[model samples]
Target: MDLHEPVTPFAVLDADKVATNVARLRGRLAGTGVPLRLHVKTAKSVEVALMAFDGTPGPIAVSTLAEAEAFAAAGFTDIVYAVGIAPDKLTRVADLRERGVDLVVLLDSVAQASAAAKAAVPALIEIDSDGHRAGLAPDDPAVLEIAGILPEVRGVLTHAGRSYYAYTPEEKHRVAADEVAHAVRVAERLRAAGYAAPVVSIGSTPSGHTPVELTGVTEARIGNFVFLDLVMAGLGVCAVEDLALSVVATVIGHQRDKGWILTDGGWMATSQDRSTAQQKIDQGYGLVTDLDGVPYPDLLMSAASQEHGVLSVRPGSAAELPDLPVGARVRILPNHACATAAQHDRYHVIGTGSRTVRAVWPRVRGW
Candidate 1:
């Protein structure tokens, strides 16, 4: 089918670009000996995950239990439910484990540890490396406390959430190093305390791309690298051309007086994630591009309603608005790949530099 055959306001994924991205990261970590526990939260399709691991099921980290269950059904044996485990979710976790899946949960509290212990579920202690989100500090007494409560501690995990804001190369390297250091420290502490904490995991898209030495780290969990977005581009982690995912929307109308080209794709299509707002350049909603995925100079989705996207040239740019009339389709690059992709049910897959739709890959949705 033709790429434009699809109705406007749908997700389009470049298959070749996905392969290039997966290979690029795999190459980077090839010599490190620390395998990538590819996070399935971004591209929830089993096809994409298989592409990441070269057609074989490998270690994966999931943000939701539904993702865990979906991947488990796909024959993934080593899975990590990377979110903090809630006591009520133990039944579901246990069910997955009963299917011969080594599913590990993450937690930082003793109460959660107690519940996991009672359920005989393995768990990793979440370590806070940069104070970006929930996790115990490397030196926190709770690390050992939680380990003591759990029957068998799997290991330690930390995400460099702050690395997204590390715009410079030096800053990214530092954040990545710190992330591994913190996770290694906690794992060593657990081993010293007589707990067989074996796994040491640390990652974030930025950290994964940065040149950090993963000395004692066992694996790195990276999801967004599959579909590089404007946020990662803004952080210097990946170039705009490296982005593999985009929302295809058609031009419905225009406001000539204000130089606004309106599209049917709004915040709902691209997501209301103004993550680049904190960066040096604020991508209002998202960067607008032609169907070929070449971004027009200074063109961006300036404003968005539930179903309307207002496209205009960047404030101080000299580039003129392209002559996109009604019915002309355009692709809008996203700010956050995970959030934007969630707005769509499936991806209209295409090959590199091609306008034909190769396949339609469905996404695994819901909690």
Candidate 2:
């Protein structure tokens, strides 16, 4: 059976769109000369990771040790666990590094640095460029403190989470440039204090697609761009058509009076992340589209239950939509690709212009 008909609630990852998205970003960074590290935390699929690096061992950023191990088993050699290093995971981190995976741990505090130093694990200082999350300030004295304390220091890095909050192209560019400058400043501070050339890195999906001067950056780590979601689209980082990940579901019933279409794809299938609410447009749970991927006019997954989704027409756009009978198939574009993909086990890939499932990439979760 085709991917559209095989199941009522399954993830349909557009293989063609994913490849295109990565290639497009790669092309954008071709002139920069700085390497781009695909953050695997979003997809958590080794196959998608392979596509990011052209099927070879290369630089990647993972959120969990399990993801690092998963990619390491699939032939990925370089992995940076982006989250702060837990005092206990140093052993496993070192074990992965010892096994030929260039695992770089993250340290944000002197305590964390001391612990990693004691365990003989190399780490990067998570720079706080956006002020939205944890990290050492760009010029904070702790930069030198951490560097001096860690036995093996990898470099400096930042996520640029503020980029996601940008409301315009100009705002996005400003945030990206600031993040690059912060990483550069931190790297310079480390160097002045006698540390060798540090690996400077900064990234986010919003910044990845926006115009930014990435002069002093050594690497770019972006993940969500692989599967553009409604939030990304709302922020102008990508168009709705660029969304590669979608949930394919079948209509089971409807609330005729209220113009609601019910589907089996609910909170269990599509994650209930309301990220798009912060943007110009808010897709309830997700945006609804036809079986062929065309968006249904004024439609959204207005609400959801454990195993059910209520699709309804948005206000002020009351044009007659196509019939959605029981068992009729539809696709759902997610608001947050990272959260949505987490609910699925394997991606039923559909290549460009191809009807059959091209590949099934298993997703890794836990720890």
> Which candidate leads in TM-score?
1
lDDT of 1 by residue, 1-367 (tens): 9877898799999999999999999999997888999999999989999999989999999999999999999989999999999999999999999999999999999999999999999999999999899899899998988998997899999989889879788888888989988899889999999999999988798899887788999999999999999999898888999999999988999999999999999988999999899989999888998998889998999999999999999999999999999999999999999999999999999987889998999999998
Poorly placed runs, candidate 2 (over 4 Å)? none
* Every candidate's lDDT: 0.92, 0.87
Name the lDDT value of residue 212 in candidate 2.
Answer: 74
- RMSD of candidate 1 to the truth, in angstroms, is 0.8
Clashes of each: 0, 0
**What TM-score, over all chains together, does every model reach?**
0.99, 0.97
Q: Give the per-residue lDDT of model 2 (tens digit) for 1-367.
A: 5866576799989988999899989888887787889999999998888888888867899999999999899888888899999899999988987898889888899999999998888889999998989898887888888899998767898988888789877788889888989899888888888887468878888887776788878999999988888998888877899899999888999889888888999999998898887777788999998866789887898899988999988767766655899988889999999999999988998875556887777999998
Best by lDDT: 1
Per-candidate RMSD, Å: 0.8, 1.2
Error (Å) of candidate 2 at residue 295 is 1.1
Which stretch of 10 consecutive residues in model 2 shows the poorest summed lDDT?
313-322
